[model samples]
Target: MNKAINAELLDLSNCAKEPIRTPGSIQPHGFLLALSDELTVLQASANLGDWAGCSAAAVVGGPLAGVIGEDGVQRIVAQLGPELGSHPFYAGTVGIRSKRHFDVLAHRWDRVTYLEFEPVDRAEAADFRHLYPLIGDFLLKVNEAGSIQMLAQQACEHVRAVTGYGRVVAYQFDPDGHGHVMAESLEAGYHAYMGQHFPATDIPAQARELYLLQHIRLIQNADYHPAALVPALNPLTQQPNDLSFAALRSVSPVHLQYMRNMETLASMSVSLIVKGKLWGLISCHNRDPKPVGFEKRTACEQLGQILALCIESREDARELQFRLEVRRIMVAMLAGLTQGSNFIDNLSSVFPDLLRFARAAGAAIVVDDRILLHGDTPGKEEIAALVDWLARSEHGDLYHTDNLSRAWPPAAAMVRNASGLLALPISRIHKHYLLWFRPEYVHTIEWAGNPREKEAADKALHGAPLQLSPRTSFASWRETIHGSSVRWHAGELELALEFRTALLGIVLERAEQMAELAGELGRANKELEAFSYSVSHDLRAPLRHIVGFSDLLLESAGSEDAVQRQRFLKNIKESARLAGKLVDDLLSFSQMGRAALRPTEVDMNDLVNSCIHKLAPETRGRDIEWDVAPLPVVWADPTFLHLALSNLLANAVKFTGQREMARIRISADDHAQETVFHVDDNGAGFNMDYVHKLFGVFQRLHRMEDFQGTGIGLANVRRIVERHGGRVWADSVLGESASFSFALPKHEDEDEADDGAQADNPTKQ
Candidate 1:
């Protein structure tokens, strides 16, 4: 018996010394590489040396799997083979070298009939993201033929770019193990295996079937030498055949021999299919004897899945092509007629193409109250009788037609002039008004066939043979068009539904944004209110104290009691000082909130050094133990940020004075969103329940005697934190120790860019 070897014969005019490049022409990833399954490199990428090392060019046509360092290549192949269990490549990191990593993925993705490649670096957080309605956009564009082929090409280019391999071909397969080249976006003048055919012996029936089921298969290398197969003892037959070769140590020789004949040492193919049939394949060919490992192989598999789903959705398939061509014109006609153009004109334009009338003149009635799509064919008397009958009937229908002249209404006799008539009731769920036309002629012309089939008036409206049988006539089949076709073309209702959802989203988003802006404006207004409160309270406090003292002195003037008056005057002076302090602190706190967040990379050690120097003069007078730890560099607003730290530090110094040797500790820590600084002191603290009250203006936790505070210091700290998109809080124990902490938002590294933000403005989010 002859082998079912499907192959392509070579045909060339002259030795095609790679063609010259046209500037701006689409370039291949590398030098052109083609090989038969024989495992000899036919061509290669221009810069294979980057991955294949210095001796790459010489390694062309060599056994690809044998050329790789055994450890990496062998393990990749093990994972490729069934013996390793179908563990996906993304399961974990397999630290393979760069070349093997790239090759392994390309090989496997194509092997299992999948497209494979590395990501376009998702690690970069600053990468640009598409601003349009991404989900909808992707869904629509992906189904276009040009779009799918472009996607395939992009996957190939990515592999070549990453692995430094040359050309990646978009290969497709037929059921008989024959590969047909579908699309190829190559790197250079180098012609690839595009349009070429590959034989079935290279990929067995079982393997091809597996490719359809799995959607991907990876072959890291072909020349993989496996461990010797272990002989098995059959439990029943006791023959070698009884043993399971499923876990065999080697790939079939027929498979290996096929690859050798093809001259392709290392290759991968991605199988694209739909409804259990082979559709297309994206095959990558590498010139040098290269080996791809497990991790890279996984990347390829993922890429293949992505490409396969894309191809399946593309309009390139025969059925899809037919559907797409028809869908556009019909949907447009529906839309233009139903929604955009004047409904009457659009309906009239659709009439000539869809239906015809030889001897008919009839009015279309839209029962203003009933809401129906009324046509004139059904006699006016018949329609009125039907309507009256419908009004009288409760089953949502009324159906008797032939002897309409005998019916109560004079218009009922008009039915005699009509050879055919139909009547259907439209309701809430089935919304369009009933259509009554000569079903024998109308159904054949407009209903049963595709609009694409329309040609002339004499023929069926769809150019198909007309059938006037009662079974296919209007009188009989009013249910079909009214019940199905007209209902399917329900453009207005569906559009209204989608519009409702999209409108809601837009409205909600706008409302949310407005609320945010309003809040910011409100905060600004509050700052002015706080300023007014401070001005009034501070001046009144001082004036009240002075007035009280003056009254006491005046009273003493008669009694000659100078000592009481003197004490009252001193109280007035102290109160005046406290009032002045309150006004100053209030202004400072308000300023913190109003300030803009100026982000920069701040060296914490240097910032702390400056803060310590400013506080050094005060520290010299007390026996305070100041412990400062090493600080990390952070990104933050400088002035307001420092104000927060200053307030926290001052609180520490003021509260930690009870002991003979006061201890104040300053330190910083890192977090996902911000850098937090803490000022810990052995001071009198407050109860846990009062923590919420601590950050509010004028909400003091302790009296001046226990722990001195204007009640605005912590509020100032909170204002500073929020300005930088961060928050601050504290924890403490009464009379034991207190730790005051504040956080400043960490600055992102300038080198990192947000890809999502196409416009550089941070305020846009």
Candidate 2:
């Protein structure tokens, strides 16, 4: 930095020794310029054929502001101040009066403010030379990279060296248009208003626009006006479409009064644009209106032209490097998917450049709605809750640097000296939010003349200085934002919109890849269903053949043998029957997968009655009491529903087969969302522990030799009920009582029909 300072001073000194190359150019007889903090005399040339009344040595190092009247300091700081910072300055001709006029050229070398004044008789002010090209190389350099840091130093050095002011400092403009001293290359023991802020509206729109265009400009004497210029007939016209160097001929009296209040005069600047956007400024200040005569003004013009390019080139290089790095990180995120890698699990691979670009303290990612902190020891569940809250907020915009640690509902966790928080909604589900935690100092530029130093000083002055915590602690924002306002960047919203589009596309592409993986899972499920169907049909075919052949052989050999032969045939016949039963069970198992419900409204009482009627012959002559109760209507396939109910009814009857006073009951209960029907019997019951095994095909609570079952009856009932979007459950205890109940969704269509008349309801089954 010191090297840069020396170079800036050396360059200014070299230009001072440079002899005027253009003979026809206007030169000052003797012009004074304010530098660092003092005043000095710049070169005087022969073009002063009329203004030679003064010599260069007389005005040089003179108290410039002191030389003018009381209004000198205020007028100079207010009018010619902006030329120092952002855009280079220049001066143009405007007739002051019908008979009075002067030739003017002005430029700001940062803090060293210079204005060359050549007063002439109205008939002739043309003696001033064209001096815009002297600093062409420097202007081009600033335009390419736009580094205000270097420009500020040069402007200050020039002001300090040429004008010899007490202090020359480059005041920078915030996005809100308020100015702050960004740099100060002044003499020792000279510091005043280095970090002070100047109003945006004070300069107004017309003056601010002028700084973006020209390489040189001036306000020869801000307080020199005799009368305000006439207003133009029309407003700003598109005819002169370009407005880089906009100027207002008339002055507003209200604003003039405001300037008087501030006691500032003389301003000039240079424009520093970053990423095709105007970033900030380079402004120079003066305390007095030392006549920066025509010769010095011409020199200031050459200086403005050269410094513009130098500042631009230096700033552009830094931005180029940043953009390249961000692009690389974006590429890595894209590559993660193709490699079959867990992109969310490894945030570093996806954004290897995140910490590089931002001095983050920690990082995390939210993938598939799961939040994970990336590091040796990840954050607790509180971080996940914080992430969820942010994702659901109405402000979907990313939070560049938010302190969530001390925030409500998440006050337990805090990160100190946190640089910034990035709330990126990078996915459609918004599951991907890249959190970049950085140190606070990384974002804040260290300043030697920071205005806040006074706030700190006030505490020290009282000897009650506040002790600030270490950098890694979360601090309150109330202090930093107190009574100050800024618009971080102009057109910032448009830039965010641009990044959103690009990032949204990236997130969508990742979503598509996830969908593809899900498609593969769906295919696997379909394959398993197909395989089960094929095995059921193929295996049942051979069982059917085996049962048929065995039965035939037994019938043919029946008469060939006596008792032994008959017993052997009996065994063979039993084996064939068992084989047939197994085939039937396998067929039932396969049918469950293929069955589709044909839901219709039906009276549960009638369905159960019909099923009972079908089983009457099997229960003939048995002393069994039948307790048939009324049943409500339910939605189910009539045939399948009958099969389901009949199986339960038959089991009730069969279990009571050995009982002397056997009883059977058919009943149901109506529940609003559904109707439940049951066939319960006081018969030989089984333990409840085996109940879960009751509804699986070929899985029976009892052996076939003892209970005589294909082992698929209950499973079939379950399948039928499930097809109707209903369910079945059983309750039984050894030798006490047993009940088989099933539920079916009661469609609203059955409500109009009475339970007794529901047998005819079209949707009932």
Candidate 3:
């Protein structure tokens, strides 16, 4: 911020003596009267003789009936009421001075009633009837306009046509509240004030706030004498009446003088409000006294609203077009990146495309200490230093600066060709960035006049606090600007953000893919090692047992008893059968990994019951109790679910053979995201410390004499369940009970189906 702008902001009281709050006067186009509840005149305009045939001094403290007759007073009283709401009420065509017709506007504030009488223009009154069609035509023009600038121009033309002012200018406010004439329509021989800039202080804070509340303001004749109220102070509040909403309320004397200085006889301004903020104004000025009737002014206000809507629509359409262009360019860049080796490697190739897309002079890609440059750029050392500065700032991944030297002074000497910079980081690590740069371009701006001179004149007048005054000269004042390129547009920033997100996604996705490839390779190696180990140990041991038993039988074939030989033969057959079982289990486990999942709604209760029935032979010889609970239907492959459950149930039966009393339980626990099924058995459990190896192929916790089985059941269970995107785990203690559980994602449709099953099978537990 410059020191002059800062000083002007601090010295606001210099213009405070302008007395805007209590002007104690009103425009001469109307006569104002402040009255008590009984119609006693508490205040009257100084020009009361023009309307009431008497001076304001004589009219003060008298009944209004004596001046305008009882009928006129009754008309004013009829509209004033507690039920009238807070807005001003109008009594149409009230007779004043016997021959003149005045539009009577009645409003009450602070327990005091105010009546304003504006002389009606017969010509304007007749034209007001046809205003609807005119406004419709004007709105059609506004909607048909191709751009926001065109729409603003149309609005100025429409307002001028309706109000018949000598000049109508559409002034647009910048982000800093400084205004410039964007469009203008005026009569011949008038000064063309198009493209002139006005300071923010021209419209003080208080005035701007009021403009938001009330959309229109009118000054009928700037040279008219201000009529003071009879009592000067409101009877109830003992303060100036809040005439903020008053149509004929007196304007600040300082503003009136300013108007005279500009040689404008009459003026009116209608606020252009867009999206609930003051976007600009449709300001009208006349060289002669111009009286606009209430009807025409009302029509203009409504037209201003239509113009505001059009302005918003045009701006949105422009933004949409810009975004569409950005999207087209981004799609092309993404396609190019896909063809490259990897995300990081492809970033350099896209730098030129990014530069063109952003209309930048140069671009660079920085990954840690490595830098890739395209077109013109700063030296590597300077660029690295600039990056370090950017990292410490709080702008996050996306930041831009038009005046790079101003932000970082050290860059001024080295970065002559690169005055502006826009940066987007590739990831959250902040180690990589995609940067765009622009060369320094000198610019010469033509201002309407010296802004500082006008500011001084404003502070000097009325002993008021420092404020901006309108400059008298419209001469072109040229100023040369340097050390900056054109500022980045909001749309460009949006494109930069999109670029950042796309690059980030590409980088993360590539990382995930590489990690997945590495994991797959590692798992393949582990599987190969496990297969070789199991074949050498388990298969070899079983074969050796068969061969040894056969040799013993052969040795005793002709010598000993036939019973011994038969026992040896039986041992050989069992060993061979165990080997065959191991091969079949291994095949099944391998197939489970490659099989495609066919997921459907499967009833867990039915699956568990079937598993238990399939193991009926094992359960019959033992004293066992089965505790089953209602289980919800889940989305899974029925075949895989059955296999997984069977392995668990069979393991329970085999492990519990030594127990005097065996017990098994099947139940499911529900959670927000998944459902867990627990299968508990009163069986010989393994040590908890070795649980990590429990799911491995051919991993065993018990000897064959005690368990009487191969050790592939749990491995097959894990493989099948995992292929269905579920996880399996086991918990156990030494020589006690073991609990096995698996969790699967909860599907909404399957869960809803379970509700119907639960209702139908109420005794499922």
Candidate 4:
């Protein structure tokens, strides 16, 4: 706490900006020397006297060759070339003095060179030959590891064995950049630190950058005092030397204090790189001052590399398998959609399989202003509101969020059932989408320490940001999480993307089919119009000619052959009337095709009663017994349904005129998709073989003399019912009861109808 330190701390943001590369001191485990291109020594570590048998005062401003001798300097210089690039160049063993061997590392920055010397133990050197076979076997284990988690666990175990550390942990990074100890191996009597989460700020961005550049870092002892460099500033630039690649370069004072607070005496870290990026770290800690030589550290680095490779391989295989599953599901969905008449109608066939695409608690589909929900979900109105919000938000074709409430605050109350939402927008123009939901998950998260408490303590102690202080307590911290859910993994997102692509293709194909249907319908309509005009004109002309000629002949003959003249006149009148009947039926058939549907709840009982009343005059003389059963209400256009029912009832009345005691019955059969209404008539039924021709235009089974009809009533019935999304069919046998039935959608429960509306309709049902 001096003013300069206080100002730097006050800036809080500049914590990562600290000049760690120019720490002005080196770790006591090694000595550092700064030299110019002319072989002049600009600075040397204060501890150089311990290794060079000289004082810092004498080494300062001295020739580099005179201190370490010309031969050692020459060997380091020979290895320093353009090929070394920006990274540190390892020159293996540089020299041996006073029964000690030293490993040299050289790096250049800003035209100034810095060389670091680490003392190597002879015993560790001798152990290298014996350690190779063990290292090879460990590598084999690393490559053979089954999963990312197992590989990381094995890496920590191997590092602990080779470095003889008390504890080793493998840490992994989440998408949010937070680090968590995934696997660990520790000595007895030590507290377990596995499965503890650390905040992202624990390692600053600058430190992460250094980890990427320098693959391995080690500290012999945190309590060992650092040694200063003589002639501290570079002679050429008058600046501190950048020791980024210095093997014994002093770590940040903040980190040193953190380690001391953690009671860690010595520590080493090797970057676990996957796909050339810093995936995590293999960290080793000891309870005592334990020094690891270069050979053992090298083996740990190699082991880390192998573990990284294993992770990449396993993850690649996992991703491939996930993609295959998505592809398979997509193929199935595509087939279901393309082979059906309507995409919306076919979705049900594959709706359950869609849930298997991801591990979701519930799912929903929205298209053409219609919604289909499965499993747990919010109310229909709430979901509609959510969809509206999604349409207006900056949502891409694929949108996902673990916390739905955070994105749309209204969804906060619905977190109980739908805390997470994964949406694939199938139609941008219409805002149609398929959504997968995840229910709220109350998770108990443990931390290395109370992050909030540590942060407060750091702020009060240093009057700065709290992230610099590493948490010292390793304990369980439990809290009830709310308004959130299990995160959607990267694999799920990729799968969603695949689904969107496939769904888009299906939608486009459906559009093409619809266009073709429209064209075909247009052409058919034009043909029907032409046929109607032609039939009306051509058939009426001949009938008019016969009537005119018969009238003229009757007038000319006066009283001659009165019976024959009457017969001729009767024939002409019959022909004219038949032609007029044909024209009326053709017009009604044409009208049914052109009419629009206005759907409403229609009580079948009232509709049937109305049709019968209208035909009372024709059934006055007949002893007809009406056997009418209770009929359900349906959702359809009332006008179209009235016409369809009228045709069936009239046809029944006409065909059953011959029966002495005519009987007609009306009833309904309810089903899941639609309700079938039957009109049975005890009449002159047709043969079963001619049943197929019953609903065809002008395809009457009975002769016109037997049944006085235009032969187009059933055809009109078919057209009208089909337009209302229903179907009409008939069943009859010769000399038996005949039944004509039509199916329609059950709109809603009869109880749901308003009492006032029911009274006005006055139907039995």
Candidate 5:
């Protein structure tokens, strides 16, 4: 029954929203008085009679002088200023009716002045004079400590001695809000809780916020009853006073119950605030009732402030050292990345430095589809999947997680090797990344109690509505953690970001170099083509003169030695004709490279007919069967398209010259993005092994004596198609047939031309 009740009461959603600031009461060790700006009493604690020798009814609607006398009222008024509105001010010791002395603390809020009075012993009051030296000695010891742990241990010992508590501990909170007992000091035989962990629920979010506002809190006796205010409300506001900064503010019953569960009668907590945040606390616990005077508590508060500064200085020093090491590694790795060299190769050479820079167990470099892994890493397929997921889910250039399984469920399978992942995307456009991995760091946690079970057993046995009671158990519990790696510190993350910037610089520099080299190569190629075109054009007239002179010489020769003369003339004419033809092909190939395209809707059927008609003289006497399919209309330069088609058809006819019966076909295939045309012929095809060389200028599989022509036809065809934003390729069987194909991109406005074409039946020619 308790478990069920606790489960309902301890729901975090309800507990976090509990208003714990206005409890309308204070601890019985002190009494409170609420007065207006004019020193008129508006409210008083019900137990004020016990301290001031006055009845609660008498104090109601009375003047401040009636409680502590006119001298005490003057003392409080003299200390009042703008600073008193925010924090409570110490008004020195005041006597009530010349009997007992009490330390008065006062503050003003919302037109009401709240004064709290706590009785002080004469000896405890004198202890204030000795506080300066005690703190000075503690500061000397703290400064002499070598590390944060040593400093914490020294602080625990000093606080225990001054407060006379049975045990004192330095509790530090992790990034996740879980507390760990970093250091401890205790009396002989006292239970030791050093190195124990506590769940975040031990101090909820609201409780932490309160600690930030009030740096110190004391519970003189955990079992003491709270003193309720007379009339239960302030007359000025008609509501409970906000005791956020009250020294005698009543703590939540849940916290009181928690102290009792630990067998602690009295406890004091001093907050360690670093960088404007609550870092942790110096917690003191007593086995018996122990009341610490105001002066000693003030000393402890100052001690906590000094300790916070030391901690901040030490942490900064440590981070600075780590950053320097990362910087050294970065310099070495960057030096290895020589400009114009392969980026992946250079990075691979410095892979060890890369891993050290991130302080990771493994690293992976992803460039396009290739992945290079070094040190310890997950399987390639798993890494690929993770990269794909990151690409889809993360838009930032950097992503990191200490618990990969929690962020991506699929990572659970590979938790052993990659429980942590730090990703840097070098190129999102190419899906390139640099990843660092950390293996699982499995360990056991010694918790103060079974956090889960205790939270589920926090029942308010008194049936208080909207109250989240504390756990009733304090047994030590051990829990084994899984599927998490060592956390990535802020300094390491910052270094990773710096390295990312450096890597991007290298990648950008290499890309720029490649682009510049490509530009240079392009200019050189154009200059070579222009040179070839100029030489070919200049040789035309010289070859024509040789042919003309040889003809005249042969016609004017006498009958004497006519046979010898005729032989010489024939050789001269043949050489000139071959040379002339070679020059013509070279000029055509050069022109194709330099020509710009004039794209229009081109009728493939009409172009094929024109090419065939130009090849009529070569195919007129042959027994050839021509099958031309209805081809799709394409967007291309008509003149270039005509030249390409003419060369392909001419090659088919020329290669099939020896066949008794020849077969030739022209066809096309239309796709969403392009149109492909094919020309196939049953001819004396060459070997497929030499097909790669067939499109080069002057490249041939057969001898010139057998083919009887210059070998620039296919080269010119490729250049023309390429200049029109298309590609050309050929395939052949050794002795059976050959096929040539070219594809052109579809233009945006080609749909109308395609719809009107006759593409349903074959056209016989």
Candidate 6:
């Protein structure tokens, strides 16, 4: 008994992999003929002799013309073309052996053409005069319908009226491949299947594939015995013909049993294809054997095509409207983003809008380790764990799932609030993301029957063979679904991606602004440290000297030694003068750091001459050789540049005072990007090792007696040059010549120069 049960389970699993295409037989209501490229008959159905008045074996090796007559064969040949591969081409009604009229349909597969012949039912033949107007009216109603449900109802009614079936239904498939009867038209005695659902397994995967290939299928009588091919295979290829596109192809035994269980003896299905995929079907079922003629089935096929277009149109318009709504909500959220300084806070403030944008029940804004939740959501710990999983799984920037528990096992614990998830990564480096969640949509599904009844019944059939059959019950069976939410639509995912892109832009902008501010703060702190050091050490020296000299003068006031008193007073006066000079220089250096740059075009030649003129008093008794070269006009602040040049030239003259003939040269080298101006002086230059300290306030390599000035001159020069978006450096050899050079951009951009200045001395702004 257990062995039999195992065999049944194995058989049911194998149903999905069934090869229904090459059934090696066809329905007895019609006969099929397989012909080679040379027109010779390769195979013939056993039931063909009933109409052709000749046995199938006698016609297997003969030409097709021998069975269908020469004129009939010519008609079939003339209609043969490339279109025969995709669908059966109707070759008009032809008399077989001049005894009976049959509708001739031809299609090609694997180097062989299959000719299917169904006896023409004259009484049910389609009248174009009636069908053309009926189809027009049906199309008009389909267009006039405002919704999908309404269109589906109209389609069912029209199909039922035309086919005269006992019942008709418009069956639509969900994303999970389950069928739902959207609309139905039924006779008084027929069972009502409206609003009922069918399991996805009711129609196997292979059957759905055929539905896409063949737009329409008709089963004349479910109880009729299948007519086997005479040779059981095509003699040319020694294989059964692929009857996927054949009009009278044999139905799968399981599917035939499915119809019998439903009390439906004959049925026809017209595939409603949208965008080249099988969207649904317009199914017609009859209690008694019913044969729909070729013309009538063609009309029904035409209606199905029209209905597909209408459905596609409605769905597209609906999705477009949804996308537009998402855009509007996104715009509002982004507007809110700009109003706040913090990204997470701004996003949190517009949480309601975000929920609406994603059509989600809850949302979470995660920035690094911080997680902010809004509306219905899992606990913070759960959300963090989910994010960690996502990061490790590497599902890319965007991920969405209707059943989160299936993708992540731990999510089963949070099914109530996080059954569905949509995640958009903002910054992978920081683990920043935007996640939307949907609560589990607990609902009861009214299936047409217990979808698992067949398996259950198989266990009872202990000694039965490995044969699968349909369920015996059609009663309403309610099943409660859990741990899942309504699936996310394509349009919803697309809008989320768009929102992510826009959000990333905002995030990047904020990051750059933060970096800029950080840089400014660092520079300010360094400047403050340097300023404090200079005030403590450099200013203390001058004050100490003055205090010492004053004390000496006071002590000498009562000595009555006139010469000694004069020397003491003189020392005090000199110390006081030095202290005042030091104070003034310190003030000037501080002012330079806080000064804003007002730049303009300045001629270096004129500036160099001006500096020389100002130093005339200092160079009066000195033998100085000034070699000034022609200089280029540069973009810089005139006041700052003048101060810098005066300081450099003054140093050159003062340091070169001991020379018999001192030489000072001012020259500039022009390059593609910048102009480098250098001041060379044959002076008492310092050692090169202390060059880094040359730009610090009150930093001096030479002693006070050797260089008789505060060490703020070179520091001032550096500050001024840097403010103009230029760099200053000095190269010197001990007791030899020194060179100081500064380079400025040839064409300075005002904004860039200002930014550079602010970066160097942020206190200026």
**lDDT per prediction?**
0.45, 0.48, 0.73, 0.73, 0.77, 0.80
The CA-based lDDT of model 3 is what? Answer: 0.73
lDDT string for model 3 (1-765, tens) is 111222332333545444555667777777888888788988887887877677888878889987778778777677667665334566555765646778877777667677888886441222456578768888678647777778878878888888899999888888768788889998998878787777676677778877887788899887777777766777667887677667887886556655665668799999998878999999999988899887788888888888887776556545445644665677678778877657767867777677777889888888889888888888788778877877777567588988888988986874567888898876444567788899898887555566565655555652453553444544566668789888888878865665564454455345435545667564444554566676667765775785586557555544425457557656755665666566656656666765656678789988988998899887887798999999998888799789989999899888888899999999999999778999898889889999977877777888877787667788878776666556789999779999999877665675453333222111211
Better of 2 and 5 by TM-score: 5
lDDT, candidate 4, 673-699, per-residue tens: 778999999999888898766776666
Question: Using TM-score as the measure, which candidate wins?
Answer: 5
The residue-level lDDT of candidate 6 at 557 comes to 42
Top-down lDDT ranking = 6, 5, 3, 4, 2, 1
Cα error, candidate 3, residue 14 (Å): 4.2
| Winner on lDDT (2 vs 4) | 4
lDDT of 3 at 760: 13
Q: How many angstroms is residue 417 displaced in model 5 relative to the true structure, after the best TM-score fit?
A: 1.0
Question: Sort by TM-score, best first: what order?
Answer: 5, 6, 4, 3, 2, 1
List candidate 4 segments past 4 Å from native. Answer: 1-14, 55-61, 75-82, 92-101, 121-131, 229-240, 462-467, 520-765
Error of 6 at 493 (Å): 1.5
- Summarize candidate 6's per-residue lDDT along 427-536 as a digit string, tens digits: 54558889999999999989999987876765555334234556677789999999999888886776576566556546544644564566756544454455556455
Ten-residue segment with the worst summed lDDT in candidate 2?
Answer: 226-235
Write model 1 residue lDDT over 1-765, tens digit each, in one string: 122222121111111211111111111121112222343442233334444453435655554443344564445445443332232232111222343333223222111211122212232222113222333334454445366556766667655554444557776655445555556656565445554554433344555555565544333345544322111211123332210111111233334334444444556655666545776666665544454443444455556666666665443233223422333343344444444323334444544322222112232333423322323455444555555554554433323232333343553335334333333332222222333333222122111122222112213322333311001111111112211111111222222222222222222233334445677554444444444454456335564675576555455543424346447647755765565456456546644544445566668777776776777776777898779898887766566557677777777777776777888888988888657788889987778798876777666677766765577878777766665555667888888898877665544564331121122122211
TM-score of each prediction: 0.29, 0.40, 0.61, 0.64, 0.66, 0.66
After TM-score superposition, the amount by which residue 83's alpha carbon in candidate 3 deviates from its true location, in angstroms, is 7.9
Candidate 3 ranges beyond 4 A from true positions: 1-24, 33-50, 53-69, 73-90, 97-99, 106-114, 121-127, 230-239, 338-341, 414-417, 427-429, 456-470, 517-765
lDDT of 5 by residue, 178-267 (tens): 999999999987788899998888898988998899899999998878888787877877887888888888887667767877888899
Task: Indicate the worst ten consecutive residues by lDDT in candidate 5.
Answer: 756-765
